[model samples]
Target: MSNLTARLRASLVAALPPEQLLPDSQPEYVRSYVYVFGATTLASFGFLIISGIVLALFGPGWWHVSRIGHFFNSIHFWSVQAFFFFMVLHLWAQFFMAAWRGGRGITWLTGAVTFVVSLGAAFTGYLSQQNFDSQWIAVQGKDAMNAIGIGAYFNLLNFGQMYTYHVFLLPVAVAALTTVHLLQVRRRGVVPPIPPRGLGG
Candidate 1:
């Protein structure tokens, strides 16, 4: 039986006693290199959140000027890079595998939505840096935002607004969506591999 199916049938197998459920905690490590893209993206996101909390506690001045703050800033920045890197891999892998097969359409949908929200979070993050770079971004973006008819509301030039979005609103949205995505995965389990051509047919 597949590992996931066996695990899901735990209650039925519980009657088998300890001798049968060997290595219950240990996962199939051999699958990690190919199958762990989603997990790796999550790990990167964890680092992003922790490092972001540190940077937030210190405020803009400290992060832009202080040495220790610079260290954490680097961590947060690199974590974003890693998050996107593994997220793309996970997304594409799921796409090609048709992970929406079976009743997993919502699972795939949640993941796709999370990616779009993460983009907004990352964009606001660039604006929250509170430096010349941020000023340049605001100047360049404000006109576009106005042209698009949201500048009055969003006000990309407003540091406090962008900072609040980067620090609070968008992050919460991403986290909430990610949580729902995870719950869906747990509910339906991962999609199984496709059968070979003409094999299952």
Candidate 2:
């Protein structure tokens, strides 16, 4: 047991050195408005999760009937909007900076996957709403799912299922993927800015 534990510790230390995992400082090039967007995106996502939890706890009906519930609902709604807005800005900035240049392809790929999955989460949230908008979205989503031959398994009209997906499964998946993406980013430090044309070899 002791030998096995030693091996595990060695492997972990080699894979993620303390300096890299918990850096005290970053490269000078890291100070830029573009880099700030990633932090903003994370902040928005944090609020989105908190607001979503409040909505889920009281059930969907409360949001439509009570003032407090409505307040939380509005927070959740606006947080979703802000999350995507910041995410898009972060994505564009990273793309322009070629963030995958320093062996960070997996980090970039995971972020992209998270965005795509978030769209599904948002779609399910719309369907789970007990309102006219939900009805319209369910009908439209059903047609789209049927066209893709996935309607049988993924019924947009099923409020319970959509709610389960939106409030539970999708959030878990997004959180897990986001964690991996962040770990990768830390493992392989941020990519540096491109050098000026005249300065290049």
Candidate 3:
């Protein structure tokens, strides 16, 4: 296992050119406020993970009954809300800029898929909160799941079940999808703006 790990690490270092990993210089055109959105998304993701760890450490049981737990839970909840909100803005801006064109279509498509999955994960997280709001959303959301024949596989009323998915299943899926999305983005590099027509050499 150690040998395999070392070989994999070496392969990654070789595959990723140092210039691509950290360039001694970058294009001047890349300098703009719009470019900051990607970094902001990364920052928000960090916040989500840290807050999630804190919530987990407190334990779901503690989170509901204790003041510190409740406060941290609120922070986690709002952090998720903020994460999705910023993600939407970033996705929309990227779309309008036609940043998906050229060879970047795969990166854009992966990101779009991630966004959709993230929404479901976020919804499930809320429903699993096991609060009054959770109860209301669970009842409301079950209809659609039932209508679509998915409720049989997922029980909204089971707090234990919902909590398992919220902390484990949904997060694993989100993280896996996010990993793929980030890899695609890194491989493709950031897309440049479309050139004006008739400027072709």
TM-score of each: 0.82, 0.94, 0.86
Candidate 1, 1-201: lDDT as tens digits: 569877767855554344333323433333545468999999999999999999989887797678899999999999999999999999988898888999999999999999999998998999998778888999999999999799989999888999999999999999999988877776666677777798974
- Give one clash count per candidate, in the order shown: 0, 0, 0
Q: Which scores higher on lDDT, 1 or 3?
A: 1
Lowest summed lDDT across 10 adjacent residues in model 3 is found at 17-26
RMSD of candidate 2 to the true fold? 1.6
Quick one: ranking by TM-score, best first? 2, 3, 1
lDDT of 3 by residue, 1-201 (tens): 369988988988775666666656656678777677766766776777787888887676788788888887877877787787778888878988898877888878888887887787788778767679999998888888899888988878777888888787877887888788777666667787789899888
User: Which one wins on TM-score?
Assistant: 2
TM-score between candidate 3 and the true structure: 0.86
Cα RMSD (Å) per model? 7.3, 1.6, 3.1
Query: How far out, in Å, is residue 115 in model 1?
Result: 0.4
Candidate 2 at residue 92, lDDT?
96
Using lDDT as the yardstick, the better of models 1 and 2 is: 2
Error of 3 at 69 (Å): 1.4
Error of 1 at 169 (Å): 0.7
**Model 2 TM:** 0.94
